[model samples]
Target chain A: MVEFGGWDMPVQYPAGILAEVKAVRKATGVFDVSHMGRLYLSGPKATDFLDWVLTGSASTLRVGRARYCMICNEKGGVIDDTIFYRLSEDRYLLIPNAGNRSAVVAWFQRWIDEKFSPGCTMEDVTVTTGLIAFQGPGTLETIDQVADTPLSGMRPFSWTESAIQGATVFVGRTGYTGEDGFELLVQGNDVVKVWTALTDSGSVPCGLGARDVLRLEAGLPLHGHEIDEKTTPIEAGLDRFVRFDKDYVGAAVLKDQQENGVQRRLVGFTLPGRSAPRAGYNLLHQGETIGAVTSGSYSPTLDTSIGMGYVLERYVESDTVLDLDLRGRIVQVNVTALPFYTRPRRT
Target chain B: MSPDDRRYTKEHEWVMIEDAAAKSAVAGITDFAQDQLGDIVFFELPKVGDSLTHLGKMGEVESVKAVSDLFSPIDGVVTEINEKLLDHPELVNQDPFGEGWLIKATMTDISQLDGLMSASDYDAFTAGPQ
Candidate 1:
């Protein structure tokens, strides 16, 4: 077990990190994501309240649908990237990163009072709930064995509540892996049962060790490691999630950036050798420091070193050659588009 | 064989002496060292002709977690460096005693190996007092 954000979480099973990584890439693996925070917001003006708080257009989501959104600070910088589920007309659930739960919740409460109707109520449901993500090609089969409800009709980013072991649980069609999977949210007491149910049926128990590699290979962004308060969604190649058509916080700054263009854009690259460029590595051009690596690792699937970093916009073009100052040694890297690996999402 | 009677360095490296020819010795990291490193993705090694002091930072072994310094067990001039680690570093994780073996160096002074821990002693040192 490893200490992460004050929580003792398993880094790998006895099967080992490499085995867990390959298992997820080849078959199915289950992850205990109970550390993530889940919040519930309800009130007459909940939609209006969320519309003012999140970057995406809240008006577009229908009941029972979830939208991937970003919460930005007053200065137009990202506070947290989250998924908001519109459970009903007045009830919404937000899933935030585990480490940023308190900060994000406080940010929302202060803003809601300043901008929304007084009927709104905010509740932090993280401690009361347990979250699990089953990701890989064979997740459906594995889930079918334990979950009482059939998940055939569930589409990506959609969720449905069902009873498992007499407890209310939420199963959403979402995952960090670039594969078709489900995120199960249940009562805190039932967490162990759900985790055991999946693992008992031959599914491997993956830890954060393999989780990092899987998400990296899929080109998903990680907070603190990849994105931070200084990073805007526009510069991170996530402009699709920002809706400028509606008035929202950070929209004006993003609009200005769109008009004037961004200074640095995040790009993916593969190292020339197997040596991985870790976070905080420097990116150089013509032997001069021009960018910095946010995250990198040796991809277990692609069998190469891959990394992501913010480079000057001019250098973000595909096929641009760059150098990574890895521990004072210069290593060659080629700028590639997002997602160095492009296997189809396991449906 | 287990080197049934070879001496080991505290850093999880082994030194096997060949008495037949010139009093020479071969050295490499032990099984315990490779197991702790997980998967070695890259190796930065010294050349065969490179000379070293008693204990030098001869090379590095990089795994998925981080890069670690590989220390010279018995010191002299490097006789041979494992060229295979340049392309297939995972071999180190697979067989640290054989093809995954790191380097061979001729001892500058025969007494250098005296300070190194024995196989049982090294195992205890690596295993931490238990």
Candidate 2:
């Protein structure tokens, strides 16, 4: 186990990262992601308060659906990327990264006090909840065996309350692994029962190491690596999540960036061989440093090296050739589109 | 268990002297090293005919979580590399002693082998004090 976000988290199970990754890609894999924060917001002004703070328009979110969104600071820099699930007309659940839980809760409280006052209530439900993610092409079949309510009709981004082993849980058809999966939020006491049920049903137990590779292969940006206090949504290529139709805290800055242009944009690249490029490695153009890698790894699925980095706007286009300086050894890389691997669409 | 036929280095590399007359030896990382590395994903190795000094940098082994430098246990000249690892790096994790052997080298100084630890010594070194 490794210390991550103040929690002792497993980096990989006994099966190892490679096997766990293969399990997720081919069959089913389960992860204990209980460290992630779950915040509950309820009140008449809940939607209004969320709209003011989150980049995505909360008022438009349909009940039982979740929307990917980010909370940005006043300077237009991303504070944290989150997913908001509209539990009901007046209630919502916001899931934030584990490390940013305290800061996000404080940010929410400040906003609530300033705008909604006593009209809205914000509760940190992280301690009381345990989160698990089941991901892979075989996720539905594996989960259906244990779910009290058949999960066949649930669409992507939709959630519903269900029971597993008689334990109440919130099941959402959302995941970060770029695979068909479900995220289950259950009472902390019931986590063991739920985990045992999933594992007994042949779901391979995975850990953070497989999770990182899976997300990187999918070209998903991790918070500290790709998006941070110094990065705006426009620069991170998350402009789609920033809805300009509604005003938000960092709306003006994002709109200005949209109208003008970003100085640097996130781009994906592939190394010619197995030499993996790691974070902080420099991207070189002809012998001059152009940018630094944010995240990289040897992609087990692609059987090659892949990486993501923020390059100057001029170098963000596809087919651009650059050299990745991996610990002083320069390896040629081709600028590719985001998502080095995409799952075959389920027909 | 470390094999009785090979000598170990402090850096976790092992050398098996194949021919004393020719001063030829085969080298690979020890099982302890592979266990610590998790799943081996990539390997950067010196090509055949490259010269290596005792305790010199030979190459690197990258796992999913980290990359560790591979050190030459003795002064030598690379005669052959395990080409199989180029396509299937997991051999290091699966068979660190046999099929995963990294390189065969013509030892430039056979006397250097005297300084290496025996299998029992290596086992003790890895096991630490009781």
Candidate 3:
């Protein structure tokens, strides 16, 4: 066990990290993501408030839908990457990373008081709710066994209200593992029942270790590593999630970056062997340091070492050769495209 | 419990004198060391003919979780590294005391083995704190 975001969470189960990662990529796995913050926003000006705070406009999001977005500072640095769901015309549920939960709530409260008070109200239901991700190629089949609603019609990023083992829950066709999956949100008291039914029907119980590896393989950016308070969304290669058509907190700075282009870009690289490049390792081009690695690991699925790091924009193209300083030993690394691993089912 | 046939070092390395008169010895990390480093995936070992310093870092072993330094228990000249570990590093977790032996070396001073801990002493030393 390890301490993550002030919560004692399992890094891996008895099956070990390799087996846990394989389970999710090949069959099915479930993650207890209850530590992620679940905040409910509602009232008359909810859409307006969200449009001002989030990079993506919640005003255009229809009810029963979700969109991935980032909350950024005035200077365009990312506060946290998140997903918000439009539950009703005036009500929405936004989920934030566990470590940034308190910060997000405070940010929203400050905005509500400054601009949208009396019309917007916020409720923190994290402690009362439980979130679990059931992810894999055959996830819909397994989730259908427990969920009382027909989930086949739900498109990616869409959600529906349902019942699981006699408990009311929200089932969303969303996941972090780059697979067809369902994220189930239920009352805290009903978590165990829902978890048991899914496991009994055949879902491997996974931990946070596999979660990190799977996300990296999918080319997803972790908040503290890839996009932080000092790193802008454009530099982190998250431009797709940023909407220039909408006015938000960091729109001015991001718009300028979009027009002028970023100085550095986040890129992916692959090493020849299993000795993976680690975080903080320097990237060198012609004996001069150019960038540093953010996340890396030995990829069991790809049978090679892969990593993502920020490099000068000039060195961001495919087949660009760079040297990774691995603890003083220089090893050659080749810049590959983001998402080193794509599911065979997807393409 | 640590095995009785070999001696141990503070860094959790175990060395067995294969042939004392021939100045030859074999060294590997202890069972406790492998257990602490779960699922080792790669090893960077010293090449044959490289000299090792007593209690000095000889190589590194990277598990799926973290990378850890491997320390030499005795001053010696490297004779051979375990070639099998290149592809199957998990042997260190499966049979740490046997097939997981890391290196074969020629001891520079036989007296270095006398200063090492016995099996009981090593068991007691590792039992304290962490």
Candidate 3's residue-wise lDDT over B1-130, tens digit each? 9899999999999999999898899999999998777668899999999999998999999877788999999998999999999999989888988999999999998779999999999999999997
Cα lDDT of model 1 by residue, A1-347, tens digit: 67875578987776666788788877789999988899999999888888888889666898878888788875668888998888888999899998889889888889788887487889998898899988887887777767778774688889898765566679888888776788999988999888888788788998887888788888888888667789888888888888887777788987777778899989999976678888889999998888999888888788889999999999999999999998888888999998876657444
lDDT of 1 by residue, B1-130 (tens): 2344677866677777755256567767778887777767888888888876655778788887678887777667878777777888878778877778777767777677778777667766777752
Evaluated against the true structure, the overall lDDT of model 3 is 0.91
Q: How do all the candidates rank in terms of DockQ, highest first?
A: 2, 3, 1
Each model's backbone clash number: 0, 0, 0
User: What is the DockQ for all candidates, taken in turn?
Assistant: 0.58, 0.79, 0.60
* Chain B only, TM-score of each candidate: 0.85, 0.96, 0.98
How well is each residue in A1-347 modelled by candidate 2, as lDDT tens digits? Answer: 89999899999999999899999999999999999999999999999999999999889999989999899988789889998899999999999999989888898899999888877899888988899999999988877789988996799999999899999989999999988899999999999999999999999999999999999999988989999989999999999899888887889999999999989999999987667888999998989888989999888899888999999999999999998888887789999998899999989
Q: What are the models' TM-scores?
A: 0.93, 0.96, 0.95
Docking quality band of candidate 2, CAPRI definitions: medium
True contacts kept of 1: 0.50
lDDT of 3 by residue, A152-228 (tens): 56899999989988999898889998777889999999999999988898888889888988998998999889989
Given the true complex, what DockQ would model 3 score? Answer: 0.60
Tell how far residue B126 is off in model 3, in angstroms. 4.6
TM-score of candidate 2 chain B vs. the reference = 0.96
Q: Candidate 3 at residue B35, lDDT?
A: 76
The most accurate candidate by lDDT is 2
Lowest-scoring 10 consecutive residues by lDDT in candidate 1 chain A?
A: A338-347
Model 1 residue B19 CA deviation in Å: 4.4
